[model samples]
Target: MFKKFVLATSLAAMALSGAHAAEITFDEAIAGATVFEFDGDGDMVVDVRFGTDDPEGFNTVGPGANQTYISEPGLEGTTLLDTDLFVEFLGGAVGTLSFGFATIDPDTSVNFTVYDDNDNVLGSTTALATFDTGGDFPEALASVSFAGLASYATFDFFGVGSRYIIDNFNGTFGSTEDRTPDAVPVPGALALFAPVAAGLFARRRKAKK
Candidate 1:
């Protein structure tokens, strides 16, 4: 199961505003798998938590000339099935992201998915990408966007030996999407179902006994 533990304040934070938008270029790409936190335009909360399935998959390359970044995944004849790239865009902004890709094998594909605070999937896309050693993409368009205001999103890679590199991650965030109600306390939730649960527990114990 996809599981994540979050704080009540973080959930509450999303209710604030969605007018702000922002993006990261990793122009100052860190050398390893680490979390970088920054505030978006007008103070929206944003974070990029870079990670890898194979320790080698987490790669951060040049904050190249003209403020560019190369987010390269390490895999030669291997596969990565899920979000090796995770982002948390709080403060309710609807946003889009673009990247510069260097290389990907012909048979390899990558998937991107965005999620709301309640873990509802907001958007998804799969692509069969290609690139040569010389590198590709002078394309300057927002290729990915959220369905609504999202609290977090993920970029995953898949396919055998799908080693690819991407850079120049530019994102734009605007108004927020329709959001779900925040989670209620367990005690309050239990108030409605407590009696039913007790009955079931007792019946199960009785049967076992």
Candidate 2:
């Protein structure tokens, strides 16, 4: 019965988020492919322009850490505008992009703005950055998902200093990725009735007996 209850809740949460997910870890990014405009070399990524500095080059550290992590190169303070990265999908708008995140202080500080093919803002939210304190760089993989069909998304790593990195992007765009939401957040309406549903289930069981 306990297993069944957990399964039901997980399913409910996925149904509520309302977006198909996709992810990528720079590991699969073509080593010499031009994914970023600034990365003239074969670096895993190019800088998206953060506070007058665009750091290019990524590193891998931690347990089984074979993925790439692009860290901000300069010390630009602890504000949201210090670090930025632009992820341009090969195919325009391949669902929402999410990944594991990490930062210097290991705090919840970052923001995101998504755009369509024409560089129009599809949506902006403060919910994109989730801090996952696991790994040598303190990784948090896609604690937040930017929902929609987007050409690309700009992620700003803001916190008490801009020493940030991301890895294990799990979403719809890459191979060896899981589009399935194992434990997505439950939607608002469903969240409200969680306790009520449990109570109702209890009542139904009592009546059945």
Candidate 3:
């Protein structure tokens, strides 16, 4: 009897733990997405060179030759503005996407867009704040609620690129409800276990007698 009680209690505890184990976070949700860092190196040139100087006007020499600056069209000899970094999430479900970025100037406007596998726009939003002249990296967050999106991709700082740093992109799909395996049990499960254990103990006692 005691053993049966202990076993039942253990199973219950395990079930509870398993059911609540899965959690969604900003990073885990969008792991499938790709990340592109512009001027990630200390170079004064942009990754997607357009043949001209950086429009953001950042000229500091850093660890790598890549300089962190915004890209804009009409910059002579510059492909930076035209270059669009993309990421695809193979999972064909709707989820949340998020990332952090700081604009080069306080007054500069920033835009973000999400696209599906077929290159269709899912949703988009613009940052209310203008990133114009301060060096401070202000973090911006954007999200879209979509369903049945074939692929997940994003375009950041669209139109008039700004010196920006982006990271921590994530997407989450799946029920928010707790449905871990251990939490599920057979009907009359606990009651059945108790009786079966008791019957075995009784049979052993009778045999000894």
Off by over 4 Å in 3: 1-83, 129-135, 158-161, 173-209
- CA shift of 132, model 2, Å: 7.7
Clashes of each: 4, 14, 29
TM-score of each: 0.51, 0.46, 0.40
Give a tens-digit lDDT track for model 1, residues 1-209.
12333554554565443322344544444445435554433345343444445554445553223322244321121245455666665444344555554333455555667777798987776655543322342211225656555666666656653555555444444223333333223577879899999999999999998
lDDT of 3 by residue, 1-24 (tens): 999999899869845643222112
Off by over 4 Å in 1: 1-21, 38-57, 62-81, 131-142, 173-209
Off by over 4 Å in 2: 1-22, 28-56, 63-83, 125-148, 174-209
Candidate with top TM-score is 1
**lDDT tens digits, residues 25-107, model 2?**
34433222223332212333442221213433433332234323333221122234443556665444434555555565555
Candidate 1 to truth, TM? 0.51
By lDDT, highest first, what's the ranking? 1, 2, 3
Quantify all predictions' global Cα lDDT against the true fold.
0.49, 0.47, 0.40
* lDDT of the structure predicted as candidate 2: 0.47
